[model samples]
Target: MILKKGQLSDAILILLILLFLFTPLGFYAKVQLMRLFSFAPSIEKQETSQKLTDYNWQLVDVEGNQSNFSINRGEVIIINHWATWCPPCIAEMPSLVALHEDYGEKVRFIFLANDDSEKVRSYLNKKDYAIPVFFENTQTPTALKASSLPTTYILDKKGNIVLKEIGAADWNAKAVKDLLDTLLVEH
Candidate 1:
């Protein structure tokens, strides 16, 4: 059958849409879309922010070493809950890695994995990521229990949760760096 000029363009467009909606390209497309749209997470106001006053929680390191949350008391902390299979989590990882690379010494970063997925280890190794990854073996602290994957909370030294983001974000953005700098000077 002979194709009309406009019909051919319409047909190509439909095929391209189907390919993006069905194949592995779909995941890559979603990641790119998320990366393009993600902005720095917003900080909470002092009066409206939740504080991590209770440091009663446990986390097991990748080496199976157990540690109490109290150890990070009086420190600026960035806690991110993510999973390997989570698309948004994957999307935000590169930015998170860049942030950690620059501020790893100044900030205490805990990348909390919701489950002990072997894929998590492999993914990190493949990427050569140096971000600290930990597992919650016990009950999560109420203020830090992530309702969704890719949830991240930035806590000031005083335990006030300054930022709580629940989706993909540009963790390496200038706004985030500025916030971290501000938190560093905070008591």
Candidate 2:
């Protein structure tokens, strides 16, 4: 077959795109893209947000200590549902860790695992993350149930879900910090 210069360049470009889309490198690439483009989640108006009726989710830590969501019921909480294999979750983890490091004393952070306990432990250990992680011991609360991987809920002191993000977001953004600080003081 005869090929012209433009056709050859187009074929090479297509081949490169195909390789990038199919190889393991694609995973890393997607994670980088997600991190690069993620934004802070929008705040929900108090009048329009969902309030939790119960805070009694049964959960177990990686070390198998049983816990209940009621422990954090009256505090500002950040509950993130994530899996080790989810690219968006991985992408948002660094920022989330940073946020937790700064607010751990003032707010409770829950890194909910949707994957196997051993795998979640290994992944967090490999990444040197000290965030608290939990696995469902019995059942998750309806308010805390995530409809998708990488979902996150920011709850105010009264159990009002102030922010519910369904995908990757920059949890370390200034607006998020401001919101947390504001939520910390409200009655």
Candidate 3:
């Protein structure tokens, strides 16, 4: 069979197009094939070396009390900066409540609601969330910046930021609880 130059070019172009379309599948297959390459640290190793004392955050307690964390002092403080209107913050309320119930005394769970005290009080009155929520007066760009809603900061026993997740997160997730437990144990 004799093919013209244009016909050969067209066939080659179509084959190239199909290859481009299916090349992603090969990339995905390679990832699956190499899945064993994934490496993760063990729980014990992760906990003991959790660097919570990185960010200098002003301390706010469960009882609506405000204080300053002197470096290497207050260990294992979970500072959740949230607002009343944030959906992710509201969705994670139950977990926060559970965290308070389970490890409130064991660790310091500080719920800093970034809103007016009246609004926070009103919101609290509706539901029975026992976590003491406080109001932070620090400016937007201060030591503890609550610029975004649902910004959570985890501080170690020595008053260092071990982790900071800026968004709504499953507070009751095993990973989160494990990390918190590790932080508490360090204290």
Candidate 4:
């Protein structure tokens, strides 16, 4: 059929829109939009063979008690870097809390907030989260910076970074539990 020029343009425009909406480009666009709005991205698991550096980092508990991170080196550690203003950070907290409930005694969970004690405490109190919260009292090491909010690191007993997730993750996932189980068995 012979179509008018205006009608042809409309058809082409619709075709291009459909192509963009149905392709991987659309998914990428959506992810970027979500990040802009502070929505957490899907879990992406990573691992590294690098050993953790001994940074003189100090963490204070809710009761004003202080402790050095070095003391926990020989134990399995899960260190999470987060901020109250970060949406992704807020998004994955529930999973972390649940994980804590299941493995609190067997693992060392350290939540380092980018904000001050009062803000972190307020946020935690509002959410009624039982996970231990702390603020880093010293300079954070460059190696520990995973370049993203809600960055999490799972360190083996020997203080090696075995798993590093750069975004929000399902801490209650079977894979995570299995890994923790294996680590628990290893000393």
Q: What is the C-alpha RMSD of each candidate to the true structure, in Å?
A: 2.5, 2.1, 11.9, 7.9
lDDT accuracy of residue 57 in candidate 1: 82
> Residue 5's C-alpha lDDT in candidate 2?
98
The best candidate by lDDT is: 2
Off by over 4 Å in 3: 1-72, 139-143
For all candidates in order, the CA lDDT equals: 0.88, 0.90, 0.62, 0.78
Tens-place lDDT per residue, model 4, 127-159, is 888887777667766667757787998888987
Mark the 10 consecutive residues where model 4 has the least summed lDDT.
35-44
Writing each residue's lDDT as its tens digit, candidate 1 over 6-92 gives 999999999999988887787788888988898888754556358898897888887788998899999999999998767799899
Give lDDT tens digits, candidate 2, residues 11-126: 99998788768876877888999999999887645573588888878889999999888888789999999999899999999999999999999999989999999999999899
Q: What is the lDDT of candidate 3?
A: 0.62
Model 1 global lDDT (CA atoms, 0 to 1) = 0.88
The C-alpha TM-scores of every prediction are: 0.86, 0.89, 0.61, 0.72
lDDT by residue (1-187, candidate 3, tens digit) is: 9889999999999887776447755444433433333221122333433443334445454455666544325657777888766555665666678777888877777687776777777778788666767665443224345668677766666755567666655566677778887767673
Better of 2 and 4 by lDDT: 2
Looking at model 3, how many pairs of residues clash?
A: 11
How many pairs in model 1 have backbone atoms within 3 A of each other, for residues 3 or more apart or on separate chains, i.e. clashes? 0
Q: Which candidate wins on TM-score?
A: 2
